[model samples]
Target: MKDIKAIAMYLPQFHRIPENDQWWGKGFTEWTAAKAAEKLFQGHYQPREPLNDNYYDLMQKKTMEEQADLALKYGLDGFCFYHYYFKNGRRVLEKPAENLLKWNDINMPFCFCWDNTSWARSWSKLGSKLTWFDKEKERVYDGNGVLLEQKYGREKEWEEHFNYLLPFFQDDRYIKVDNKPVFLIYRTDEMACFTEMIDYWRKLAKIENLEGIFILGVNSCNEKIGMDGILFSGPSAYWNPIISSNHIEYENRNGIKCFDYETIWKNVMIAGSKKNVKTYFGGFVDYDDTPRRGSQGVAFINTSVEIFEEYLYKLACKNLSQNNELLFINAFNEWGEGMYLEPDKKRKYAFLEAIKTVKEKLESVVQDDNEELTSALKANKGLSGNVEVINTNMEKQNGKFKEYYFLLHRWLQLKEENKNLSKYFMDHGYYRIAIYGLGVMGKHLIEELKNTEIRLLYAIDRNPQLIYPDFEIRSVDDDFPRTDAIVVTATFEYDVIWNELKKKVDYPIVSLAHVLNEM
Candidate 1:
């Protein structure tokens, strides 16, 4: 059961456009409030106004297309727009999410996470008033009367909330398990009666025939606040019963406890059975609630690309050897929280690379025998050998050696998989070839074989927006050359694409590894 897949949540505050612009503090065109709100709403519920100046600037700088690209690049299981409902109960998550869904229906997978929290002057309010006004606003909670928040729900009120949420619950993008839709409760403590609130929800879901489960975002200290939490298991949630905190302190956004993977994971397994629900894990990049909290802010965890990649790879390796059934990630595009895998101007693709590496490693591990650890190691043999051997060696390396090891490991994986389908020369007659989807591995393969005879057929991708040269390109559904063409693809969800291509062509489907070996 260790053969579990990973899922991630994407929160795109198109409203954040202005926020992004302001944070970056440059490169934004003048826009009116009405027009900005209309454009920002795009496919979701309409906003009363464009997000405040901070958010408006963010949206003005980055488009939805940019956001979608960032989600796919990270290999997320799915994405959910942060559908908001407030101010006389207005709702908007459908349009933009649907639009994103339409853009990349096949290759890029997605799902939704309902961010249900209050919108108040105290909650939404950031920084102090007065000349300190020059300072960025910091989100501060008074903790005076948490019970009085307008969004606080009695059991019946919670049911009413879900009633309004029924449309999204029926959609495929809504996360589900065992035929039940998953719903996360943003801040559970806000409920006046924590224990009674959950019991009521359980009763309501059964009565209404709705699949509802509330996931709480518990702060530090690890106290059992009585609601189920999204638990972390090492670097990934491959195994069940992840670590639990009696009370984990919440230090602004993204600033929380940093626990050790080995210690935490072992504890989680035993606790998981007692908890009765599957636990999850997440990897962190850098977190800066500074936008919401100013100079008296929380410390950010420095998860450089190198660290992020290694943490995920090792976590995947460990999970592939476990008995868990499902996994979850912190997020896909929560730019405000700063844990996004999206490509920033500074880190081109540091986060996306980690996601791809974890996915490839997991898939490669699954194709091998799982009963014993030996088969896993054996699967990492030379070229077509087992992946575990390479993983094992990589772990032993110190410091900078890790990067070179991964580069070669990735190279080997491509060469092997490519060899299978790309071997037109030795196996068939050494025919030339081309690959579609010039993503990370595709670009790497092209670089490795720059001097070889296998001419790349015009590289194509589903993203009509990608601009690359030296090859013909087309959408995944477009009719193209398939006769004797040694075709390879670089997108994830290969099974989906493989099935699609099988319907269109008679040629054998080859991988980049197969193509590289012959070269």
Candidate 2:
């Protein structure tokens, strides 16, 4: 069976924009709100902190590359960026997407979701006070009291919109379904001329010599709007009534709601079972928009890493049965909304690990089943001949399958053990270290070292041309730094690197696999 596609909803609001600077303050970004958040009630977690301990600017290409690496490591199929476009070709928070397009080496598949709602200045009293009022008092602006209105203009603007997205659709990395570029409309019902817009976009796509667009409606509004599929937003949208009843209400806090996180997960699973439409369910690590909403923030309380893992496993199984093979995560990094999957101070990469665990487990089961494997291979290659040979070989090798399973089990165990070994080395004064091979495994090892006291001296690679902004890549034959130790991160040529390094240097050498095996 094919692996389930997991697309995370990505927010590009981490960069500075002129509109945001004017509205908020100089150099203002999402972190401003996120850092300012305070606990609204007892036992309520607030002021969420990133594991990196720095507010990353999205303008940096390195940040985007690291994000892509993390997403791929966790088995995410792609990202659905929240594309913000207002009337008259106006756009905000577009640099990240543009940068992704420009830097071809990022290597992450991507699509767009037109957040077709009007931009409102509702998070603060200063922005919303002037535009919205009730009896001389400021009223809560419900996202529609727009500062910049969203207008669906005539054919010219529609053509312009399609033209703007044409380049992205043409990109090889763009995510598609059945040869059609996948686009999402966040608020399909809000646009009166959505049908016309869809038709125009589809017509434009055909003119560009492409198949029709796979336009999906977000939330429960897809039914009313004639979308090809529905992408559920999150649990809050589906179980609001249950949440409201079980939640805590605060005095003078604008009816801030708080619900048991586990209860929400249970309700979501129950609701998912009854769904019949072609839909993609969303899974969230946690949610608490108090940073943006302040006193009016709603949160799913008691949401631990373990709870999130369970929720993800259930959601993954549900998606597999639904046959959509797509599971949309609520967010990659909506830090202000407290729904991000990025590593945080409280739970560093725990959410990401949960995703990886579920995906690997599910995929492993499929691969281990001989019938499923044969079927998958036949379907993938459109093979009609000599499948018997493959099946015979699989059956003959069945007795040795236990060894393969054991190796797989050891590999998974080593992943965790290697992480602990990294910490041990750091604690024992292995601060200066050189990593061999600047591959995916090296990147993962680098991330592990970030939490420790280790300092990377150089990234050694066989190919000297391989460049990474995060570290200086040097050829293995280059002069070595007087390092405390050398850690080999190459899996394919581990023995080759180890033998070659042992010939040149007398420093304490350790391979990642060696450390894991020792543990």
Candidate 3:
């Protein structure tokens, strides 16, 4: 099976710039807004803090090295940095990428995504605030007035833009598809003379003796716009129908809308399966832009680490099954937007662990299947002489025997693993424990522990509708019965459940796979 390349969108607004200093005050950066954010509603998590208070400055080269190491460790392919370029050779937030190019020791794959939208002052209260450094002196409010235009200039400007990117395209660490350097346009439809701009870039690449660019149009409603491919933004729009059907009233606090992350994820899975376009799907870890927009910030509630894992797993599997090898995450360190995968104070390394676990499990499935088949064949060969002859004939006459053997082998493996896991709990003095999933794995685990000394606390699942005759099914968000530890039974989402449990309880959480492997 071809390995999936997971690329995360990167934002470079963490470091200070001259334009920002003049507009927002001296030493101003994304951290300023993030630190000053207030909770707009009850249960709203605001002022998101990083793990170990690592409020890193992007200007420091060590910070970039640490980020690259963390991303590679978690199975990410690279980062598509959001590049900000405006009309007349103006650029903002270009220091990070420039610095990255200068540092040869930092080894990480990377690409670019042009944020082609015009910059405006809508980040604050829309109509109430005027842009601080508007050269035009336009007092227009509602944040729609352009502070900087994205005009498609003549040949000179186009050449300048392409020349600026030629070095990056030639770099060994740049990401490519079919030898073409991959680039993304944030909003293709919004750009003026889109086709001309792309043609110019391609011409420049050919002139430089490099492969042509593989440009993709992002958030284009799955439409082709003279680019190599399209990329679905995320659950933001795909789940609109489900959100509407639920009849949930979302209060537009300031300009921000509220929605449920679980609801969106469930719908996203359904939508993902129905997609017919050969496009890359993006996943959102958690979104609460309160740090940037405050009361006007959009937030997705009930976004536990478990939901994110399941969502990404299903999406990744879908992409692999469809033979598409690219998967884009919304962000790597979009702390201001609250969609970051970096370690945070409340859930350190949870998101990163989810990505690693899903990738490892999916990649191991085919190998495990082969191992099982080999063992079954060995066992069959060891049978009696008459039985071996009959089995061979049966395998030739009908393939059903092989299917039956595979099923039986899987059942026996699950039984043995569950038994070992139950013993592990007992050996560790964990008499009272809670199972964190209610799917097939959970059922097997419950059956294995039924006769053991381990007392079963209430079962926890994200689905509130799930029920069991012997025990009550409680939601992960609810206050459940206390236990010594939580055993995550869902094999595919073990890390996700463990991350969620760690935040809620202080017990030593364990996964079924870990227990079985140890035994």
Candidate 4:
């Protein structure tokens, strides 16, 4: 249930870019917008400052490295960077991601969400105006309603764009699903060419030796396109009219929209539940784009760490209940929009701690068992027995850890349904069972069968010396003991373990997962 991956949406507009300099002023960055923000109402946070005034320059490698380390420490799965691409293969504000691709030591797993929306002056009109007075005589680029246009061209343009991104797709740190690079499109509604483009990109990815490109729409995606899934962009998740009516509007002198934070989050969860397609539910740290949209901005009030964590925990539980893979967070650092998880002066690491707390609670059982496993491995590393086996399983430990936890979850579901494993074995005439693999699954099996008629005779494990089960501990090399069945708790290696056990004992061998599967 705790296996959902938490991927945070990332904003990379921190550093000063040439286009921003031309549009806003010299040395313009997201910090400029945040610094110039005015308080919209009483008790409203404005001019939000970073912790220790750490307004980072994303172009700096050290800053990015620190960001990756901090995120990983807090248990985030990865960052989904907002990728900006415009007409004719033009990309803006790309230095941060470019540097990420170039700098291998950052250690952050990442994917891209192409924000297909054009840079329109109306939406961003609150910021400093375009200083291109003596420039842009051309009609389209003339600082009209549009600052930058999003024009999707034909095959040539698409191929050019993919060629440029091929390296990123091929990068070791790029987040992939089932061997395919996961690519996100922020607004598939605006992309008329999405179906063709993604289909083409998938073919391109295959030609590059990739399985294919895994596409997930950030907002509304055309379901016919075979998008791998859809991610609900939260805080204003498409702002459904029916749900938007639930907003508890605040009386403000300005005409900006005010939403109850809790209401928006509830809407997010409800929206995800109704979706028939796969969805990675999203959450926001906070939302107030007054800096970017001024009085026209949309703000969600009554935000707190406690409330965020509560909804986030609920979101995780919801996703897990539905078998969703990840729960994405909005804006890891979108300071301009006032949505960020990076430490700030007002709430230094509270948001990050919130994520950590949720993850810890979700992985409580896994962590406890993992801690013991770690200690056991460390203590027995110098020992003569099972050293080779331990070394061999080291590479598979991470994947096996999750696999075991999944079985634990399945077992719980069966218990809730009154389909007891003990009853299943008893019904099949297996009164005595030996648990194979005394790690987490084995320990859990023993606990489940305790005091039940399905007696646990002994536990067979690789490192029998390390495990202190109530029953006798025996290595696979030891003489076989007669039992009704041997439940192989190390599900990943069930076949190999089963074969080994079958040669020595006449007992039936079954995987812990498969036992639940049959039941």
Candidate 5:
């Protein structure tokens, strides 16, 4: 059965519960340390518990029970706790996680996602001096926009953190692979400091008489995390703060201001489509951490459960059984950071409903025949919906909505006309044409036809800048006469580009892949 792997619980350490509020309620008003510092100096806010109201308190077993309850209620596959502390205080990450392991003895299974970034306000910390907190609100008078400060653990502090994981490594509930426990590190680049972090982890795992657990680093941080396995960015977009190095500016198809998370999730899957890495599909309910500092003026985490269900459906179609590829969710409950899949007031059971729906659907057809699978695939052909774009003729087009609708339309009509041409070429045993689009389908066709006469010796795109002097690069708007041209589009959207060519070119415009197969 396909595992509906999703994380929907929050680590008790960062989860701050306000005195008479529900678990998901905003506990404190957003205030950064600098703002707190300024406010303290200015007498605006006072500390409730001396040092900080958000003190590390995982000792509360009651909260731990609540955390486990949220996990079970949401149909989450596992839980991940953010491991960190304020400055050089006591080690706080281990307590809550340990508590969960104890709770899981008879309850649900859980795992740990190790976030290795330094605990300074300068990096991952909210309201620290190094983010876009105050300037976005125009409240503070700092340097306006960007803040870049490097506050990581010194050599000793990192060692202490690593050492604390020994017990977690031994715990069977700790998600592991083979015999070794599996630990996920947040920023892969941070692994640079203790070049031997992985080696040390292995050595420790060996000493503990267990198959050493691996430390999977962030996909953005591709540098070796010294573990046996690595974690790929699943469905939810993820960014390696250490890799992007704090370059937060990103845009999506709608030209919306996208954080780095959106960029990776949307772009990376097709970015290196030809690469050979086995990827685990990821899913998430939402990702908005701005609440930590009380900035509620953004759509940081307004993701719809409907969209999330569609993603799960896709995973099910791809044969992601529980015993096979694991579907890692972005979080269980980073409630303070606002990426919870659990039930909330505004949309009670919305996310959990998605999980159950996907789970039930996937389980129902677990052993389905090829015909059923094919029907399912076709039914959800555009489950991601149409990538609608207004073409030059103002007609809307779908599939890969990049450009040239007229050309795309003509190409589809042409393909229908020459649908029987494939058998003709196969009878002749040889045919060839130049191929366009070096994307996923194009690459696959190229590989399949490698030994055949329908060989594509050159690949091209519409982009002029990439058009090398020797390579054939033609823009759709260009008036180049279609000689022996075969318009190979990766998907349906480009069919419009082909239709545009029909109006001008009299020569044969064929399916890019079909012609290549003939060659």
Candidate 6:
């Protein structure tokens, strides 16, 4: 039932590479930048720490093993590792990936995104000026000097690079679409001899008796020649002045750039809206490079697990149903960029838990739809697939996705800003309660009540035949069990249900909506 693959972008820079050691200093890793970060202003969340202070080194094989376990455990399909290969087969930051390949025991599926940008020490050290967007538009990391240059030699160089990648590509764990290994490269227009290089790779792939590579452009839709697809990079794909109203604005007090997390996600939600067959969608867990760039960095403020799950769930339900392309999350462990899915101190595993929640719910919806479709086929005794009926059912499930978020958001908000349902029940002496109308809202109410001291007696429904293994169900026709109150979920027909239910049971009747809003 998984309609689209969820591949988290991975960073291998957690392990010390020789080039990084020489350029930055000895023992320098992503943890160095993340650990040294300090809050630049009030409300700034900095010095992102891994849970249990697990500042792990990727060089160890167990790191990869645990990472693979975490990813698979939390509904991620694979990892799209950032591959750093340059001209003349000169590569750096490859130890982790090498180990992943070398150690067959680690169960992880992965692909590559060639991060072709040149690196320099100056990108991190922004002196007194600290102005946002002064040089940011030119590149993500702006610096004067270049530590290494990315160049493209002729066919020979292309062949050499392809040769190095062959083993990983050939590995059974490499993700593929239609039997072709998926590859991503940034700035295809800027990658010299890009088309020629892709063509050469395809030729070489064919020689190895494998399908030609499926190369996707990284936020680049410029060329149509050699590229097979396009994977839009979140915020970057959605960034630009004319795109919309939400954009970079500097802090008046400190001249630092700050963005509303909601605003940018609103922009990102529009990505892949048109259902481009050759396009894949992308999203980020969160983006805050302040750990790496300090005040000179760009940050999206006020992000929480609830907000993230809402955005991701909405995006998944909207887009994944229409495309066959992989949905790439910005990163699994780019801690330096502040865009990792790895568990951290403040959030713990809430973000990862959110992924599991969304994935299971989506799959459940899909399974329901398929079962309904099968029932329709059997009833019709061979109709024309009942495609229209399937769409209608899907649309309803989509509405449920919207409803779940809306209610969850409002419920959470009420608990903090106003009187919550739990307090209402306790104040009213409804310690033991029964839910009337065991439908969507009733189920949501049941879940919300679990955090409180209220005890669920049972549920009342017209058709009590429905089986819910989690809780007991009772027929409204039967003598009601003793309870302090009955919370009705049928808000639209609350009056009618109340009149009928009151005649059957001696308990106060209240609408779930009234309880939530009256708070």
Model 2 Cα lDDT, one tens digit per residue, 1-519? 556788898989898888765556666688878878877777777889999796899999999888999999988888999998888889888899999999999988999999876666553211232321112233333443446656666568989989999999999999998888999887553343455467668888898999989887776332432357777667665463321122333233335777677877765554432122366667777888778766556777778888888778666665655556578888899888888889999888989998888788778866675554444434423321223244234322542343234334545655644545565575446779988877666776787677667788888888999988777888977888778988886543443465577678877666654443333
In candidate 2 the C-alpha lDDT for residue 478 amounts to 89
- Estimate candidate 2's alpha-carbon lDDT, on a 0 to 1 scale: 0.69
Could you estimate the TM-score for every candidate? 0.47, 0.64, 0.64, 0.66, 0.51, 0.65
Better of 2 and 4 by TM-score: 4
- Model 1, position 328: C-alpha lDDT score: 53
Candidate 1 lDDT over residue span 1-519, tens digit each: 345656665554444233325432233222222122221111221121222322333332245555445556655666544555532344543455555444444344444554545433332221122111123344332443121123333335656665666655566656665556655544332222334445556666677676565443322112223445544422322222122322232323333333333333333222222133333434444443333333433323334566666656544443343343345555555444445565555565766777877777666656764443345323322211222233223322331243234335645654555643334443554355556667766676667556665566666577867766776777766776743454453322333455566578766555443233223
* CA RMSD per model (angstroms): 27.6, 27.4, 26.7, 21.9, 19.2, 26.3
Estimate the overall C-alpha local distance difference test score of candidate 4.
0.72
lDDT of 4 by residue, 89-197 (tens): 7888888999998898789999998887766554332123332222223333344456776666646788999998899999999988788888888755434446657
Clash totals, every prediction: 69, 0, 0, 0, 41, 0
Name the TM-score of candidate 2.
Answer: 0.64
What's the C-alpha lDDT at position 125 in model 1?
Answer: 24
Off by over 4 Å in 6: 121-144, 241-253, 272-277, 370-519
Give lDDT: candidate 2, residue 246: 28
What is the C-alpha local distance difference test score of candidate 3? 0.69
Clashes of 5: 41
Please, what are the lDDT tens digits per residue for candidate 6 over residues 114-183?
Answer: 9876555443321133311121233323354445556665567778888989999999999998899999
Write model 3 residue lDDT over 1-519, tens digit each, in one string: 566789999989889887776566777787777777767777778879889989889999999999999999998889999998887878999999999899967987999999876666753211233323222243433344446655555468889988888888888898998898989887554342455467668888888987799887775432333467767656564544421122334656546687778877655444432122355657778887777665555788778999899778767765555456678888898877788999999999999999999778667763564554344334323321223234333323333333234333544655654544567787777899888888776787788778778888778888989879988889888986678877776544343455466678866676554454334
| Residue pairs that clash (backbone atoms under 3 angstroms), model 2 | none
Runs of candidate 5 exceeding 4 Å displacement = 1-4, 14-59, 85-90, 101-106, 122-162, 193-195, 221-227, 232-278, 293-302, 316-324, 369-519
